[model samples]
Target chain A: MNKIFETPLYPYRRAPEQDEERIMRHKVVVVGAGPIGLAAAIDLARNDIPVLVIDDNDKVSFGSRAICFAKRPLEILDRLGAGDAMVEKGVEWELGRVFFGEREVYRFNLLPEAGHKRPAFINLQQYYFEEFLVRRLRELEAEGRPVEIRGRNKLAAIGAHEDHVTLEIDTPEGPYNLETEWLIAADGAGSPTRRMMGLDFVGKVFEDNFLIADVIMQADFPTERWFWFDPPFNRGQSALLHKQPDNVWRIDFQLGWDIDREHELKPENIDRRLRAMLGEDIRYELEWSSIYTFQCRRMETFRKGRVIFAGDSAHQVSPFGARGANSGLQDTDNLVWKLRLVIEGNAPESLLDSYDFERILAADENILNSTRSTDFITPKSEISRILRDAVLDLSAEHEFARPLVNSGRLSVPAVYDGSPLNTADALDGPAISRPGAPCPDAPLGEGFLLERLGDRFILLTIDADAPDEIEEDGITVTRLALSVRDDTTGALKRRYLGDEPSAVYLIRPDQHVAARRPSWNENLFRAAIRRATGKE
Target chain B: MTDLILTPNLDNADDFYATLLAAHEGLTKKESDALHARLILILANHIGDNKLLEQAIEAARKAG
Candidate 1:
């Protein structure tokens, strides 16, 4: 096993603020150095906004937790300069096969045929994911960007205020006080910041435990997601197996509610289960193991005054759909840009309300999907179990029953269909590329469309008349003029231009569509920019 | 918008009930419940339309 988590990647050191009597206020303080916190800090720092990320632990996450990273989050990470390394190190797989007993129920393809840049999903250990993010943060620091990570620095207490928040941080040296214009609570599901703030997650709690066993082994198994329901190895209990990088495989065995938690984690018990599945002749070494129960919950709102919650701190879903870290990255992607604008006074403070409006929608989507998956995997009632088993059995024989089998739908980026920032549809575009939806990627001659969009508010005109740039109020909407010829595969036409001969799209910094029209009209585009920036 | 077939599509209800009882013969309670679930799922899928299925479910409930 890789010793990536044994040593502290970011060790704690005494800072000048600890000695100085003057309390220094930072631009942003992200409480937790996990994926969400690091992404938020890196994005802010790259935008020239000073950000500090503090975590209780100094090492990478110990186990191979959260192995699946979806396409959209990968794209967001790519924008943060962390995607290439992760894609290179991560195992790319898309096929998920469901099994009932010894017979295969059905198989599903998670990705489309072509035209997209990223894969359906990549399986990398959470430690490696965090390590790559930390590496990206280091590069930003090397570039003299104002980003700092203080490990072993725990938030002892939080004082929320009308304008800003006061943070009492406990380091190995001692306790120090700092103020921040904005507080981003990226702590994990068991968030201390949330507890201090008296915020609670309100949702369903599943009454089942899953023993996650990550093992390093040499096997000729194809790289595919294998989920078994009522398998011979673990009859009546569901089991899930995923192939990760470095010959490591993640296997989860469902342990029913009310089991001896410590006894179930015994290596002998884990080995027996593994032997039953992989056979006694199988050679493997246990890497890591943990038991977790499913809880699909989220806070009422992500923002509370100057304290804005992100990732697990705000909402948490069962890990079945790989929505945990993936959604966390999107949270930072959606948050950092808006925060940067507000910090620079480019947008009103009220624009932050849109963050709550948008992320709450995404969180609800994640929670709903996760709860459904959990209910399917672990049937709550006898009738439900009978129906579920019927679906599984019928799925193996009939094509009609396949759709009813839910081994957890693959994670997809949430389209903010009802975002307040979105303008009413003016130009007829592909439904997938509608306003408030993430822009579908299409090859543009040599590079991808999202790479061109980057992190900017752009007026993307396709065979439409538009100026080089338009300055509405204080925000400048740069134009990226394109022709149908640039779409070699015609995916742009199918995705962006539906049946309309020409189209103009106002793309947000996060590459979500803000507004669109058939052709660029300055008056309408100006109003669009105003509405998009929450200026109206 | 096809409604549920509540007016008896089969000519003899006695034969249909006897056949259903015969299918449940020698089966345990759990097995009978499983068979019933499978039959219902099959019929529901064949019915296809959710509105029509909702009507059928409501009619079956009212018959109780």
Candidate 2:
């Protein structure tokens, strides 16, 4: 029997009356309980910053949405203690094949190089992703970290101030007022919080529509991404098929702009389309179906005084590239650390400005890539279609044209090339893992390099010894030395040291490289730290 | 590498040009433009090197 996912409703509890003598104030209050908000809550709670998360709904996501989890998000999740469960429940895949009309045009491997800690990508339902994060949050709460989750509570109104923000929340019984020092608005795409604040998401909305369906079947298809452009099965349109956990598959059929959504979603029509794509003999059961048109847009500013936006509330993109949830998780990953420092009085509020700058750049990158993919998949004019078809026809015979085939350019980690927090590159090191980039993971001793960093600044040394301890201001610097261990297999040297005998890398609490030099100096290290914390 | 191929490479250049023109015959202006766009993409894909493609694009943009 195929297992069907059911969203369990949480019972609502009455809030304390507004006339109470004193109301509880939290350091951070996250507005949504989706993947992004929950990740931020978990990060803040893990850092011992008390967080309260309020959600209008109680259950997990309803359908199989946002199935692709990229490596960078996985790394971030691992830091939050939920990575192993997701990897265990997900179908890991890296190979993708693109076809034009029945002929195989090109194939690509996402992670051709090996020795990384995480896989290239994993395919799992969005509900399971949120459930795993909620589980991790409960584990942290059990350990006496002040992380509270209140469901069935909606944010009715919001007022921002220079010092804090006041929120009016409506519960099942009545309404109550709450105040928080920092507000993380992670409420999803149609964010009520964003609407309440009168902020607009500005960008382009593609005219094309896509039909997404989740079906459960026992078939022997290879566990890889298969995308067809104008295939015989679906005439003159595009189709994508991906394997997920529990013998379920996700199929997307691109319908033109003039589709009758209601008529297309009928059971008989869906069955006919599935039959045409998967053949009559393959007996399958439908799990879910939806019609969607996506927009590649973002808010003008991610940080607005005391009210900060993350995830879909701040930016949105088409689902073609699997960048939506992955980038949202990254937004929270980039945000929580800065918020924690600012809340702890260790870093100035100016540090949060860097978060806005860096993530806006990242959002722009995702939007640009997503727009290109949308344009390629659904050509607006005859000229565009002609060029797209020519590229497809030539890709089968040539390797160079394969890169131009953008069947959703899969998500990759964004490098902050000109981030204000990045220190100048004074050392000759591997360009692949540079300042402002996430530190590449390699085996160190019995653990991984990423496992040794984060939660505090790290001064990582490869093939060299550093001082026993370095602590300045409120930042605790942990010194880690990695040499040619049996498990390393020269990965550490290749990734960090390059040709140098010894090198020092300064990594931030978010595991982003802050600076690097051939040799370590206390004054220079302090200067880099000052710059990273916005002291300079 | 120099992108200019001054040497004669095609064996039947006259026939190839005739066929190319024939492919455009009887097409409207919009259709001809679409065909030209497709031909450009196909030929660029055939010449896979990006540096060479850049040089070719610059050379084509320059007026004689």
Q: Which ten residues in a row have the lowest lDDT in candidate 2 chain A?
A: A1-10
| lDDT value, residue A290 of candidate 1 | 96
Off by over 4 Å in 2: A1-5, A17-21, A106-111, A205-207, A485-487, B1-52, B58-64
- Per-residue lDDT of candidate 2, residues A409-438 (tens digit): 778878888899999987898997789988
Angstrom error at residue B15, model 2: 8.3
Pairs with backbone N, CA or C atoms under 3 Å apart (clashes), candidate 1:
none
- Residue A193 alpha-carbon offset, candidate 1, angstroms: 0.7
lDDT of 1 by residue, A1-536 (tens): 67997879999988778999999998899999988998999899899899999999999999987889999999998899988898999998778899888888788776665888888778999999999989989999999999999999999999999988999999988899999999999998899999998889876555468899999887677888899998998888889988988889999998887789999899999999999887898889899999987577889889999999999888888887899888988998898888888888889888888899998899888888888988898888888999999998888788888888887877899998978889888887789989999998899888898889999899999999899988876788899988998789999999999899999999999999999889888888888888888887
Regions more than 4 Å wrong, model 1: A108-111, B1-28
